[model samples]
Target: MTDSSKWFESLRVSYEQGELNESDITHNPFEQFNLWLQDAINNDVPEPNAMVLSTVNKQGQPSARNVLLKSADENGFIFFSNKTSDKATDLKHNPHCSLLFSWLPQHRQVIVKGKAEEISMQDSNSYFQTRPYGSRISAWVSDQSKVIKNREELEVKVKEFMDKYPENVPMPSHWGGYLVKPESIEFWQGRPSRLHDRIRFTKKANNWTIERISP
Candidate 1:
């Protein structure tokens, strides 16, 4: 198998579903995301808040995973993960990270690069309580990113936690929230013939500069 041949293999679709015009869009990147998110909701795009979070360790090894965007604004996009997880460890060592949201149904994508910060424990508790009981229990049971013997051991832990706390579970101290404060945010809309629309908002010493990018 050759790499170039595999790379050219296609499950391609012509992006005729959505169009982007210079007339419609907000100056702020967050505002644009909010508009797109609302459209996704209206169109019944499944799990529209979900986005790919990319992080790197101190050694510059990058990792990525799909995570739900719990919050977003000028401060940047927010998501939560276990403090003991590899992602958390990586963030501790390197605060810079990026997030990508591909709203394919709308033929759109957004990319953000930023520095991450941990939010208050009080905030974590508030969101934790909103999660389903099973999810809360799973957070307690799983030693996220840690090595376990097998599924049986994990099941045992879940069972033990469930039996001990049938109705309510307190949010773990180590489990909390993190926010990414963006340095730059780009909005991309797919156009025909591989000529895409890309608009970028870059932060400067005191202001944000907007520019159109080559696709």
Candidate 2:
């Protein structure tokens, strides 16, 4: 095989897009996050709401995957998935999790440390009804994260679910949303000479404390 180490070392980019200063950021982490998210959207970054969710299982083994951020506010962030999925299982065992938003095109990233809890079924159903018909059907068909024979098996089940719910598809009991209440949020901005800017906001008793950390 080709020398992959050389290929990896040969790739490099100088980050000079912007600089983040404490004076430039909002006092509230949630507002700051929204500002960066809006910047990503304005820059035409694909899937701007996509975030990496990291969770640790009961065994302390960590796992991470990208999931779309369905909503965010002062309450925290929200995302949905199959209740029986591996990530869900991880959350069930360990509520503490982390979320990462990487906007590489803009040379910025946001990290959130939080505790995730299941949202009310009523809220989940409301969002579920808004999904496309095919998506709703797929939710019922796939046992997400479960082993199956092959693509044919999944496709067969898909067809069956489609036939069963040709009209209004009801949300599956196994599928729902989780709300993550953040305890801390950090924003990182890439800079020249690898001297990145790091700003972190820690939540205290009904207030937030901001600090600038060394790169």
Candidate 3:
């Protein structure tokens, strides 16, 4: 096993602090999610909003990657990336997706399952313009997920972009955001004896149906 695998295998902490219950949760899943996210922020979990975004290709193969959570509202979670990338291409064929957020230190985890949709161009433009100069330039340089010849070639193109744009870097045509409209969300809280607690909220008609699940 790798170092990381051995590290997990040697974990000794017995989670005994929290438990998920209906009364402890917000009526609205989105609001509850935001609250948990805020806690993650407050506790300074590494990359608090960073989540694993999973998508399925046309051939039914699953792929995933770490992506920053840019925004979240009543509609759902949002993250931005290259529209021409593998994840985006997979999204085009299979719009369904999953976003997993793990707060290991807090013994808490959240999973969101949803359908992906493109945000408005106006929204994309706004977010793009706010990014740093280097990031904006990298967005222009990287084709994302595409095969590259070598590291030198990639850096060469990046350097060219840097030289070309001595001032501000304009947003690339292929970069934008995708919103995940969640149909269901599950929140887990670790407890003693490995008897964890899980609360699930599922979208049914216009309202959400909340239910407790065995953990």
Q: In order, how many clashes per candidate?
A: 0, 0, 0
Model 2, range 1-215, lDDT digits (tens) per residue?
Answer: 99999998888888999999988899988889999999999999999999999999999999999999999999999999999999999999999999999999989999999999999999999999999988999999989999999999989998998888889899999999999999999999999999999999999998999999999
- lDDT (Cα, tens digit) per residue for candidate 1, span 112-150: 998988999998999999999999999999899988999
lDDT of each: 0.88, 0.95, 0.92
Structure candidate 3, residue pairs in collision: none
Two-way lDDT contest, 1 vs 3, winner: 3
> What tens digits encode model 3's per-residue C-alpha lDDT throughout 1-215?
47897798788678986777888899999899999999889998999999999999999999999999999889789899999999999999999999999998789999999999999878998999999888988898899999999999889988999999988877788999999999999999998878899999999997999999998
TM-score of 3: 0.94
Clashing pairs in 2: none
* Estimated TM-score for each candidate: 0.92, 0.97, 0.94
Q: What is the Å distance of residue 194 in model 3 from its true position?
A: 1.5
Superposed model 2: Cα runs more than 4 Å off: none
Would you give me the overall lDDT of model 2? 0.95
Using TM-score as the measure, which candidate wins?
2
RMSD of each: 2.4, 1.0, 2.2
